[model samples]
Target: MKHFAYISLCLALCLLFAGCTRTRISSFRVETPEAPEVEGVHAYMEPHSATYRFSGSVTISPKETMAVSGSYVNYSSDSLMQQSRSFSANGYYEFGGSDVNASFDWFGKASVMLIGFGVGYDDGIYHHLKVGFNTSVVEAGVYLGLYHQYTTLEINGSTCDTWPCSERDNWGSMSETNTDFYTNLFYGLYASIIIDDFFMSYNLSIYNPSVSGGGESVSSPDIYSHYIKGGYRISKHWEVNAGLIMSFVDPDYRHFAANVGAAFYL
Candidate 1:
């Protein structure tokens, strides 16, 4: 099938560019390996259901991570489905982390469809603040943020995914943990372009974390993360995407993942 071939080509390209660096088909992360992160644009350029919208997506990185994210948007009072100006709140809760990882973002866009522009804040591990501009076909942005890495102690327990926990609960556990935190700074740039029903995006980020002990602080080696993705819209309310994600922290600490995802608009 054409879709199968497309995915195969993507994987081959990822392997080719990964080079001789130690590569694992796993989630990419800056700090905790257990907390694999997948980042990308979660919305489409046009064909929104209304001025006020809700959207959700699910992404899976083969042998790596799976995540679910959602967004809510409020368009400018005078606008309709095609957002000329809007504000949005987004968030995700993911599995495949040490335990689990959850984060949120707030974003605003202006002058969309023509020369679009936006600013946002992310409470994720990297790139907490972002600003970007877009045209009808192209988009670009940069982001910077601070993260705290921590060593955690967990004992005698499990994790929960819902409120009002019950005995017959899935992924339920009794656990307690404490963390010792260190500081990290991250900055990144991303670009995306859309043509017809096809779109592609790329993100690159650098992370630097520091540890303090014995009255002295030492900085760790910088880590670089990359996410490249391409997708096609199948219908007005549905789309499918596939991409490659990678991170480098020297030759011995390289990580890669290939992901596929779908988004729905409402």
Candidate 2:
């Protein structure tokens, strides 16, 4: 019953937006490299421009939910070691709960190939934040990002539902579908590629929250997610993307997701 409702919501959003976008990964080797000098399948590519992207996704795991994401990129320039920067926001909505995040990054400089900060929120409950850094080198025409995230989920509760399985306690005020609150420090990696009007990306991220309630610390197991997306430009300013997301806490708690979205260049 709960899964059905979430699925319905995700479908409705897809119909409403008919839009596209994907999460941007940091790569020290490239800042959207310049399109080939020759014209053909990759002629529409532009290396020194700005863009805004948006996407919608569905989580198919411990529970079902609808996730939406958007991002903004600043035009590349010669200043600050070939400067490139971007800001992004994303969220997931399920019955009785939601989780959202905002992040920013600046790259194109060797001394600081990748610098980023982000914040996470679960409706009006726990508060969370993270900071990270990464560097990458081009390999076989793709740029990979090597990064780390330090995250903290802080709230007054000693108990809450963390996902993997189900909640065991009736802990006061904890919604049946809220992301577990905890603090964690972990590393991850990412990759991206651009070919003319085509684009693709992949990411593997880590999350583990440690919390305290009743003077006792509640430690949740580590969570990992694998994400991949592909996109194609349909016009000078618009692109459509689709991908899969897999997340796991354990063999007993693994899930899959699919997403579709668009990107708009400015």
Per-candidate Cα lDDT values, in order, are: 0.45, 0.36
> In candidate 2, what residue range of length 10 has the lowest lDDT sum?
30-39
lDDT of 1 by residue, 1-266 (tens): 66456545644664677621111111111223322232334444443222222223333343432221222222112212233222221111122222223433444555552121222222234326666655567777777666655643222223333322233545433433345564566677877887877888888877653422212222335657677888887877676777776766556556565556565544
lDDT of 2 at 178: 22
TM-score of every prediction relative to native: 0.48, 0.41
Q: What is the lDDT of residue 264 in candidate 1?
A: 53
lDDT of 2: 0.36
Q: Residues 1-266, candidate 2, lDDT per residue (tens digit)?
A: 66456545644664577621222221111011001000011112223322232322232323443333334453222232333355343333222112232222222222323222222222112221222222232211112222222222322322322211122433333212223322334445555565656766666666443333222333334556666767787888566767776666556655565545444444
The global Cα lDDT (0 to 1) of model 1 is 0.45
Strongest candidate by TM-score:
1
In candidate 1, stretches whose alpha carbon ends up further than 4 angstroms from where it belongs are: 1-31, 34-107, 112-127, 150-183, 234-239, 251-253, 264-266
